[model samples]
Target: MTDFEYLEPEDTRAWVLHPELLNTPAPARRNAGNALEEAVALAAALPGLDVIGSEVVRVRDPRPGKLFGTGKSEELARSFKENEIELVLIDGPLTPVQQRNLEKDWKVKILDRTALILEIFSDRARTKEGVLQVEMAALSYQRTRLVRAWTHLERQRGGLGFVGGPGETQIEADRRAIDEAIVRIRRQLDKVVRTRELHRASRKKVPFPIVALVGYTNAGKSTLFNRVTGAKVMAKDMLFATLDPTMRSIELPDGPKIILSDTVGFISALPTELVAAFRATLEEVLSADLILHVRDISHPESADQAQDVRDILESLGVNEATPQIEVWNKIDQVDPEHRAQVISSAERAETVHAISAVTGEGIDALLATVTGMLSDPVHEDQFTLGFDQGRKRAWLFDEGLVVREDQTEAGFDLTVRWTDRQRRSFERL
Candidate 1:
């Protein structure tokens, strides 16, 4: 008997299809070759698929019927048959009708960009909240494409595998099932979100400014995160390497400690499903005092990648007034001659820094910049704390704000040098 949970993944042969609209810029404004490369990388991120080939199909006008012209469709179908390709990954959106028609015409299981992203998320999510978010997103996406994808479940046989419920058609059952799953996942997700809010409130009591790292997929956010905080946070050279949000406290040289949050990487054409479902995770970005946009300076499409990150940030409601620093990373990958030019450009742009997270080159300057950005002009003041207010006094000293203390008969006299935020927290006591 086949176990449901441990079902083995089929090693299917796959080919990636990218429709490069020659007349229009892609969502990330990437050129055809770069777009195709990214699409292939996305496909490779998922397991159980041997991607044999990928191509850029240039189209002036997209078809609402088959996505590609009849002649091109027939040609690709012949290629698929020859390669025995079991799956075709369309690196673009497809209407339900077009998806169904293409699958029939191509005689292969087809996954649009959204579906492929959902699969990767489902596989990579580690936390409960991450899992629930991915599930809700997947369910929402599947709800739309159920017509073409769930045909296998259209069976009258009374069996366990993808069968309809009593007196219900397959589509009805699937819709109902999807609706129920979404509701169930949302219920669980709500609790997680609430707990996160409570945790955020708790973090407020700690009085550290939150700095969040955001970048395009495989742009080295995790690597920079690890280098800065000395935390082993899975710094892999892969797309969406870190799905879950991780936070750590890092102290600057001669400056106060701040919380640094490493978030999921932004991607070109991030699916609406993910954007909606991952809002809980993106909340960290919203609450950040500073956003560090790390970029792979060596990548050919780095400019387009930066634009895509900004676009996604806008969609997440990160306002224009928010403080963001551009970090031109991976300088180690650049040639010595070109590296000097990059450094010169970064020097010209005060907000941009050229650094290598791997080699720690230019990290001190970056940290000093971070310290400057987060520093609140601190002032020293004297305060009296009674014996009963030992907790408050301890909190002050624990924060490294207290410079000196004098013991008294009834209480203690403390001299504290701190920021406005620390002053507010003290006042709250």
Candidate 2:
């Protein structure tokens, strides 16, 4: 057995272990408490799982075989016995051997953080692209746990089937099932990607400056989307309320048209599988002329959540050169004093705006900021189109790119001022 290097906790080590040498570090559990709450929230969001109770188990010197110390494991087991808990949700990563060991000792089903997230994403994904991505991510994750293959759960196309009796049977893990499934999903996803590329190319002809709204989950992204676009999208105070991407054409205060894309909200420790799978989904952000990073200013972990969004953005290949605006949302929840302070601070920041999407406060300023940002270092050009080029002429007008036009006998002479992206789109057309 390889000796595991359980990080010796700083505080509470002397006390927790004097009681028992191998007791989980209390400080570690306290640090994990917030993550455990988030895990519980994630469980609550999912269907089919009845969460009885959840807590953080701090393992001081995490053992290779059992993870927790003998005493601590017995203590948790007693609690499980008393509560008749059916499933144990771990807030952190777990090795397969430790997972098997914990299940045997506790006599209940178990799901670690990554598995739980993957399962939730599996349940929530709607479109064909989303489904394929989930399957690919799940298979990739499951590949790691092939060491202990139990496949009693009936495979469902929609959900990652983690359902069954105490001791289940292993089917796919043995026959390179995941490998084959991954290959198939990749082939399908490739087609979807190509189709998306074509759609994007088509969108280029229309040439609407894309302004994508990104934020932490439950950060009022959907609510803001509805407020800005007057388009009713599902807005709820739930984790991952909006899964699929949605876009609508919205006009700025002064009438320049830009496309507003409401993207899937981000979260801390987003599953690697989901990230890779959904990168295609977030491809909207890549081409976005401006990225509006909406944030929940009221949440205690708002700063941390903001950092997580930044991390994911970088991971998804958002370049530093791309224009990004920080939108501090939910100021309506704050007191008047705090709200004033927030607005003042945002005003001073170069590319930050504070707004309450629900109350419509500060939204005007935010929109004006967006318009100004879009209009920076504008490009003006002229083109002569024949009578047959009415569609192209109409496209230019529709995009609000035409500054002046003179009808000539041959056709129309048009003067257009537009961004480089708009220019490129016009060229494609």
Candidate 3:
């Protein structure tokens, strides 16, 4: 086995390939050109890589040893050599054998879609739990790729070892070693999950409804979150921009206070290992009182992308009964003619709202709709409290539930209109 770094220097020249397999079922095959563009964007997301070029390779007959036929493989090898490409990113799954063979033939490092995603996750995970989850998923992915003789299992940088290190010898990771690492990570992750559960439990006692934002990657979920909460989450025009979930308490206009959760964006064909590992992080969505399914209406493949998000939600066992509002975001990016059509279509559906988070267009109406959906039925009640019970009286006034107050000889008499949740909270106080 030969040991060598996968990537070199700070800027690795990279090429992206999206194989459009003609034999694949129509439902499973994505738009080849659009998929290629997304793959290029993903390559651009990583910090140290310089994407030189991209292509959509049409594959009529799949080859077992190498993904491409011999002549095509040689042609690509020549191009890679000429372009000085250090890495080739395939926008689909490649068998371990195929990966090894392609690397040997092309004389460059090969990363499949799963490995690239893992690398990005490793780079973007901020929280401790998120880091552990990405590590576990990377280990699971690396376990299978260990079949290749030139395996680089040691990390010399922030990202997972899938991308090469500088002047580092490749170390073969035995199954036992990988398994032990996984066990250690699982123990840490379990502790983190327990702590998160405690926090969630505390939030439940506060009577604030949770509204979770979920959508495909780079679909403006974080942007919408920032627009609504005024919190500076990393809202970028890149894939997997936000990895860890962020929560903020926000009061809807003339409505009940709620917790808004912005979670890691979903992607089409998300790695199964990651899906399982990040389940703990996504529990916020499962517990949400309402879900906002944000969509990039400007994207050509918007409908397909929306379906992909719905598929992931279903796989995560999100409650079908949970109320969902379709937020058609990025309307400003659409052409004026198309934008008008989008607005018209959204107007026809009560559950759908078309708005641009960046320009603040149609945001008030969306907020009003959210207020209406989250508002609970209110009833009037009278309460008598002594002057000494100032804290309870203050709580009612702060919540804006007091209808009227009258001073009395005993203490004070209050007429309040409040929801069941508020009433319960008041009793607890």
- In terms of lDDT, the best-performing candidate is 3
TM-score of each: 0.82, 0.78, 0.82
- lDDT of candidate 3 at residue 205, scale 0 to 100: 59
The lDDT per prediction is 0.85, 0.78, 0.87
Q: RMSD for each model, in Å, please? A: 7.3, 11.1, 9.3
- Candidate 2 lDDT over 289-401, as tens digits, reads 88999999987778888999999999998877678899999998988878889889999998999988999988998999899878767789988999998889988988888
**Model 1 lDDT per residue over 1-429, tens place:** 865667677688999988987667545346778888888999888988899999999877888888788889999999999999989999999987787788778778888999899889999999999999998998898778655345543332122245554333766777887898799989999999999999987987677888899999898999999998999999887888899999999888878799999999989889999999998998988878788999999999899889989988998888765678999999999988999999999999989999999999988998888889778788999979999998898788768888999999979999999876567556645
Cα miss at 242, model 3 (Å)?
Answer: 0.6
- Residue 271, model 1: lDDT of 97
Clashes of 2: 1
Q: Candidate 2: which stretches are off by over 4 Å?
A: 1-31, 148-175, 377-429
At residue 25, give the lDDT of candidate 2. Answer: 53
Measured with C-alpha atoms, the lDDT of residue 355 in candidate 1 is 93
lDDT of 1: 0.85
Cα-based lDDT at residue 36, candidate 3: 96
